[model samples]
Target: MNQFIWSFLCGLGEAKYLNRTFVMDLNMCLSGAHTEDGKDVNGKDFRFYFDFEHLKESVPLVEEGDFLKDWHRWDKKKGPGRMTVRKVPTYKVTPMQLKRDKSNIIWRQFDGKEPENYWYRVCEGRAAKVIQRPWYAIWKSKRLMNIVTEIAGRMDWDYDGLHVIRGWKAQNKKMYPNLDADTSPDAIVSKVTKLIKEWRNLYIATNEPFYYYFDKLRSHYHVHLLDDYKELWSNTSEWYNETTAITGGKPVPFDAYMKVIVDTEVFYRSKAKVETFNNLTRDCKDGINTCNL
Candidate 1:
């Protein structure tokens, strides 16, 4: 998801540089790490996870499907050789060079391997100085933000946040030897007591699968997790209804990625945010013994 966001930003920067309408692919693929079954899933609507309406307002853009439809329509009408297109097969051909081409279409093909195929590669080296990725252009889906608002509203918009990064990191004794022990319920309660007042609403943003993992903290604070507000994304909810309508009536699963997105956003709204690496544990985020770097 981070890679896709950066790549899209690079593309948007290129379009801005050339003063051309940015053609966006509405259909996106979810990485295996973000999926429920740990497998990549394609055909996910861009609007399902992002604010496309907001993006339209931010940049000169058109949906890929709509753009291709118009392209084919024009081709059929004019027969042949009427439209001008410059097919750029490599990132080595910089955007600066194509600034005044006046081509109808500047199609960039990223068909190479590894680092070569990355879309953001166009913004590297000297081009990086000129093409500024408009990070402000991309916004989270309003539907997801609605869920974040609902979760915050449940706590009356007054709460402290705890981000406990456990899961595999805790299990890996080599790198994060103390992560599991540090993030244990008893450890959490002991450490959080000093930072957050007792009985205060504590919204724990964690990857811990066990629901009862944070039960110890409940004794001192009103513990809240992403699962606590499952109804917001459940079948009977507004999110379900709206997303289904977009996907030809197919139900969209509130997968792991969506959970993380909501959890992080909700955490951001907290009056006091306590992070795992920053507060709960001394372990480095990337791994052990690399904190100075």
Candidate 2:
């Protein structure tokens, strides 16, 4: 049997697809009689989890959700820990390989005309069932959920979601000229004010300054930001903080990324989810959001 290392290199936000590819790879390995360079490939040891070392160094933590409940949490010098090898034949798999036609290539690599000397398989796919329930489903982190819930508790009232609507879409003015006009604070307030009745709370998620819309929207709805709960998360997020420190402050980027994930998750769970654009067109003139160029 040929020894191989499977390297899954992708951001946390793309875990859903990554997971699908992972399953496909596992099946391919099984089919090809290639066993992971460790204990039994069918045991819990074969499961994937957040690479804490990578996370501390700048990699974002995996998206929080119930789908990740079984993944082994990485603890420093504890738990199963991350995969460590001085050197090995590595097969690098990426998110692009998860697509339809590209996925076929992955199947071929495992069962086709690849030279036998190749020790690494850097692609994805080859599953009996490509897309399955648990593979595509997302789950939130319990710790993050608790933190966000506690923040909500401070408000003493239920709230609706208000995603401020900025990112690749908002950045491309030439491509999405109307995106700025549509997602402006004034426009958002105008749209949301009419829809929401009884004037309750609005949980805000944005890439811009909170105060920009704070005073204007407060007249009708109590405003909230992911930042408001930072202290709560910081105090209790010992493991995250420790990991952050270990990497010499590089984890700072992930701190913001975590907030975004939390914000998106909270928005999804909200009674009403609101965005700037009635339909944020994935179709962009530059093919930024839609096409993979």
User: Best by lDDT, which number?
Assistant: 1
Q: 1-293, model 2: which lDDT tens digit per residue? A: 11322223322223334433221121212222212223333311111212233332343233333213433332124435542222212324333444433221122233435543342333335421342223122333444556567766776637887776666566777667667666666776677777776478788777664456556788888778877766655534753565445445543223443465567767766677676544333344353354455
The pairs that clash in candidate 2 are 64-139, 64-140, 64-141, 65-139, 65-140, 65-141, 66-139, 66-140, 67-139, 92-122
Worst 10 residues of 1 by lDDT: 74-83
In the range 1-293, model 1's lDDT, one tens digit per residue, is 88989888999999999999999889888988757678999888888778999899999999998999999877775645667889999989999999989888999999999889989999999999999898888899999999999999989999999999997799999999889999988898899999998899999998888999999888888999999898999999999999998988999988887888899999999999899999988889989998889
**TM value for model 2:** 0.50
In angstroms, the error of model 1 at 169 is 2.4
Candidate 2 stretches with Cα past 4 Å from truth are: 1-138, 235-254, 279-293
Best by TM-score: 1
